[model samples]
Target: MAPYQFIERPTPFNSKGGSTLPIFAVTPAHIETGTIDPIALDWAKKAGYKAESGSLLLIPTEEGHLGGALFGLGTNPSEQPYITGKLARTLPAGDWHIETAPLTANRLSLGFGLGSYRFDRYKSEKSSAPTLMIPRDADGADIKRQLAGVFLARDLINTPTNDMGPNELEAAFRGLAAHYKAEINVVSGDDLRQNFPLVHTVGRASADAPRLLELRWGKKGHRKITLVGKGVCFDTGGLDIKPASSMLLMKKDMGGAANVMGLALMIMDAKLKVDLRVIIPVVENSISANAFRPGDIYRSRKGLTVQIDNTDAEGRLILADALAYADEDAPDLLIDMATLTGAARVALGPDLPPFFTDDVELAQDLTEASLETDDPLWRLPLYGGYEKDIRAKFADITNAPAGGMAGAITAALFLKRFVSNTTSWAHFDIYGWAPSERPHSPGGGEAQAIRALYHHIRQSVR
Candidate 1:
């Protein structure tokens, strides 16, 4: 069977296929105005569907067929931008179209498409999902491009570590470079030790081998945008092993790398006018005698000596090298994404990622973009006073702060030390996976903050 297709061909105004199911997005105030068809209104009233927030009421035809679905948007429709996304899963399987709604047709269409995503790579039987017909006035191209980037991230993160190790990530990285004619390079194995010693130290024990992947694109004179992602394909906590429960979701440790590439796809696809560079310290933090031990000291690519207070803190070590590499160029913007700390998740919960930046203008732009794009981010203070938290007694910095108080802030400070040249640098500590299903996001690997960053860049470049 053909895979689910999201964008449909342009149709006449208010056009819907015969098999297409209508979805009515209504608010409580609108419902009381006697606007809905009497039959649907009667069925809805009897079913206790008061059009409250997040409520769903299925309408039946006179012949008892699946006539349509009524989705509640509460008092304010904008507050429930993603409410219609639920329709992709809840309503019976068929083509779906929006009959009435306050949201832009494009946003609603994108929400529906995002909800249609399912990871069936290892499944024996794949279930069919309800498909959405792209609305006539909607920017189908933009929606498809964004959805493609998002699905790329979701697929990469959802794959088990067995199939998504460093080597496979390199292949995917290379594939993206080849698609856009980007300059790509990879330094792996012992070669990594010569320059990126920290990256090599953390990944040496894995069978797939450790590597630094680089991709550069766009014209040289354009504004330079550099992205560094922690590509710990599967983090097993190294010698300092995590408990079985903690290690269960290690496959998504590479979510930062996945998201970086996903955003790269959007930048290239949209032909955004900027020079882009993506650096990923792709590695697996696996256990073996060769694994870097806790308390070991290693020199980073940036020439700072680091002491591994805990082997589980390997992501920061690799990112230190990559961010240092990115900082050397002193691009217009430097952003690094990582699944850095559990403290971040505990502080902000799963939905909102915490970003650290001293540049006020950059922070303002990101805040506006986050609001505009619906990709939420919260700013966490760099707290220069906490600089001592990451200090190493014998080395330049400690990978793991001993007290673990303000772990997230200390981790951000640890990364900040490597970034001296770049003035507009921000670090995003993301959960990378949704703890549970949301209206527009599935349970597995979810892309965070990239859309907002993309919007910021798009505006900056123009």
Candidate 2:
């Protein structure tokens, strides 16, 4: 599918000979007066604008060309900005500009540009949706950079698992590296056994060989940021196995890898001043004679022995090795993401992911970013008390506990053992799929924490 065209300038008066739509911000007070002041007042009056949030009004222009649109945002002194994602599907195809508002030009541009995304990859019949044009004064480069990352993540996640296997994921990473002139290295098959034993064990059963994909960019001597993602391309629970119903959406098991790549795209596109390193262990946990069995013990890259209490708990095994490798460099910051546990969803639901971190200030920054971006995340405690669940009698730790309580916390504890060197580390346990369609999000592979993480890193690190 062709990528959507995004521009970042002041609102254009003409959009390829199509009608130009002016979007105005409205309030309850303005609705009573039947006028939006700066735009057309009479049209708003006739439309019965009540200034209720998300209300949109379209008025015909004096010329035969398409007219403008007025969106209602309830009046509150500190009301959040960019609450109009639903506009993506509602707005008619044409150029649009914010005519009246106090929002920062950057925020306004980003809000509209992001709202325009649609996953039309597999649509047999093409969509005739009209493209929205940016204003002349908007920051085009930044808008394009952000949208590119978002669309990249959406496209990768939207593709079904049958086509997006472990090998295919590696190809996507290499493709991105080639596009940006970044260096790429991949360790697979026998090489993985020698170097990334845990990663190999988790992915050995599938016909596709498991691999560790690495991409490095930027010059030496810069502050380093290492990203680790659990790339279980398709998990069928290995020998432990999942019921057919439970495994239906297993294709999205690699959501963590998709998100990291999305963030990487944003950082590189914007030329953020940091040496970025991305490590993903791409594997498929399918059932076969070669698949690792429950109760099997494997030595990890960190030299800690891990007992596989349940083959279904395979995400952490791959991440354990990748996290160990990431910690070896002791980067300035280490972040790992995965669709790890259902317990997280039980605690915070699907919309809000739980993040684990030891740094108070970093947690505060992430919280603020989540509020600002409307991408909510709740901080989950590392809870030192839960550490005992991961300890193994014979090995350093066990991948899963025989008892099922605190599944998410135990999983986090398992990954925590591998991340000792980094001073500030954050782990996000995300449910990558959206069960139902909403305004900005369609029901497929959703980018759970991408926006919040992007904002936090850009503000704090860069």
Candidate 3:
């Protein structure tokens, strides 16, 4: 097996070992009070720097070389904690350190590291971005671990389907498992069809065989935390093909898997005390003569027959089999993530992914962690009211329900059916792609919900 080109190299934070310029993050209040360096303040005044949030201004030395810089925090600086991230793009290529900032050292450093990401694997001219020296008070190792996980997910998601299909995804999975020295088992072909029927059905159309990939790590006696991600490498919506516009970004259909892989990296790197299991049902929902069609019914691994009301609803079918298989383990926590519904995007937009879980403590902890880590997550109800919608006339359940109301909820509910054995289970319907650039994230395959989950898990282990 030759080295897969798509498995990205780890992009870590820079150490504070060399010459670095200072960056002072100033606010309008600071300028008004004249608390900043007088020379720099006067220069900012001459430059008409308004201290607008996310704005940057570079100072010059009398010798005409790079000097200190100013970053604007605006009035309510705390409103956007990752505001310093923009500096990674705007700063000249050199080592830099924060002299003063409204945000904590951890946030400022983390933001810069995240903004420094570049997915230029295919480009002839690779990106060259400035680096920030890790703050002495910040957890540099933890930040590096987080960035490594995020970069892994982003790279996997950003890769085109030609380089990231089921086979490639399996290779990446195997690579990650090998890196961590974890135990991995993959089921495909006849075994997958016989045992995980729904996963096989949704994926049968692709040239590459569909696979159920599982990775187990950590000591057996630790708390069991099992994660399942929908690995639809490419979704042409099966026989119910998507329009050209909808198909453009389908390479990111495996975002859920990417994210969990990243989160798993964080957990494994941190050496968190937990038994971790990752389940990825890998497939490419393509158009072929054998592609599962609308109205097709297939029995799942859990013995529940699923009626495919729409072939585009293939993610849930694969997840159904994976979740059922995971449920049998009765892990302390069971989580499934997927790019499952457009309705979630319509409801919450892209930045904030909606998570569904009935566990109160888990929701509260995740809410706290989201705020702490700045990983945006909103909890949507697993509303029992919509339970009747997924019921099918002939099969046990319909992969897609009619009247498209609360589609995200209905999808969560549909996945919930196979998860009865697990006491604590959560589902995240993630957009997984940043439509445009943001403070800490660029416009490409994004990692959603994992940071909060990582912090939540860390706290749980403690």
Candidate 4:
């Protein structure tokens, strides 16, 4: 897909007349009051603009050329933030500019730019969509940084499993490393067994060798921030195999990895003050004679023995090794994301992801960040009492419990065992896929907790 074109205006108040399409804002009550601009009101009235929020109006100027559109934002000016995204989609296929509006410069710029995202990689005729020009007063650098990360995540998730396996994921990480001049280290095949045994065990069955990809950036003296993501490129449920119906959309099992990379890109691009470490355990959970069985036991990097209660719970297995490796450094902050359990979706649905952390202060910060960014997350208990369910008579712990009463909590608890050294650690069991399309979010590989996390990390390290 071609790179997104973002236009920067010289000044917020100066209206550059290069755009072919113009969008005018209107309110429902404005039509009744007749107090709006006479020229705009007349044009709107002629175009049958009722001024219902989210409704679009297109008018033809006196010239033969096509006129601009009229968008309805709600009565409250503060609600205008929601309109930019809607405008991105409602506008005609031509260059557009916000000539006049009540929106703040930053909100107007970022919302419109983000909403304009569309994955057209496989499309025969690409979308010649109009570009949105940012006002001079707007934070163009920040807006572009955020959008770049988001588009990167969407592109990765939209890709099929055949083209985005373990090796492909490593290549993608390597590209990011080369771009940022970060040091990249990958332990795969035999090295994985020697260093990250649990990661090797789960991915040993697939043709693509399972590996742990680590990228280190920033100065060593800065505060350490570690990110762990489960990169199950494709999940066939291993020996416990998923049915054909369940296997559909399995390509999205790597959403966690995509999201972490998205957040990493944002941090690196912004040059946040922190020592960053990103660990992704790339694996393909496929069926084979060598596939780990339910009764199999594997020793983790931290030397904890984990008994496999279910082959389908391979995500936590790979994450176990990555988390152990991350904990070894004793980072100031640690976060791991995975589509680990179905119970999280059952509890919070697809829109809201559930996060678990033992630190109250960290939890509060994340909750506030979620509310501020409109990317909300619900806090689920680590529930130390539930640890008994994961106890293995022969091993230190079991990957899964017998009864699936608290699947999400148990999984979080399982990961918590591998993160004892970090002062502040959080785990997010994200669904990663949007079940349906919304105003700004599409149905495919959606990014969960990225905005909130970015905000939280920025504030925490500062």
TM-score of each: 0.94, 0.91, 0.97, 0.93
Candidate 1, run of 10 with poorest lDDT: 3-12
> Per the 3 Å backbone cut-off, how many clashing residue pairs does candidate 3 have?
0
Off by over 4 Å in 4: 1-20, 75-80
Question: Which ten contiguous residues of candidate 4 have the minimum total lDDT?
Answer: 5-14
Q: In candidate 2, how many Å is residue 461 off?
A: 4.6
lDDT of 4 by residue, 1-462 (tens): 332221221221223457446667667677767766666678888777887767877767778467776777767756546457767676766667776677777777777766676766677887555567777888788777777777777767778887788888888888887888899998899778888998899899999999999999998889899999999999999998899999898888998998999899889988999899999999999889899998888899999999988899999999988998899899998999898899999998998999999899999999999888777799999998998998998899998798889999999989988988897999999988877766565568788898889988888767
Model 2's alpha-carbon lDDT is: 0.79
* TM-score comparison, 2 vs 4, better candidate: 4
Model 1 lDDT tens row, 107-174: 78878777777777678997767677777889887888787788778777888877888878888888
Measured on C-alpha atoms, candidate 3 has an lDDT of 0.89
lDDT of 3 by residue, 1-462 (tens): 232442446453566665788888999988888899887898898998989998888999889877889999889978888877789888887778888887888998888888888887778787677778888999888988898889889988998988888998999999899888999999996579888998888888899999999999999999999999999999988788899999999999999999999999999999999999999999989888888888778899898988889999999999999999999999999999999999999999999999999999888988999999989999999999999999999999999899999999999999999998788999999999999999887789999999999999998998
Residue 319 in candidate 2, Cα distance off native in Å = 0.3
lDDT of 2 by residue, 284-317 (tens): 9998888899878999999999998899999999
Order the candidates by TM-score, highest first — what do you get?
Answer: 3, 1, 4, 2
Better of 2 and 3 by lDDT: 3
Clashing pairs in 4: none
Model 3 per-residue lDDT at 319? 94
Q: Runs in model 2 with CA error above 4 Å?
A: 1-19, 35-39, 61-65, 75-80, 135-137
Reference-based TM-score, model 3? 0.97
**Candidate 2: residue 190 lDDT (0-100):** 74
TM-score winner among the candidates? Answer: 3
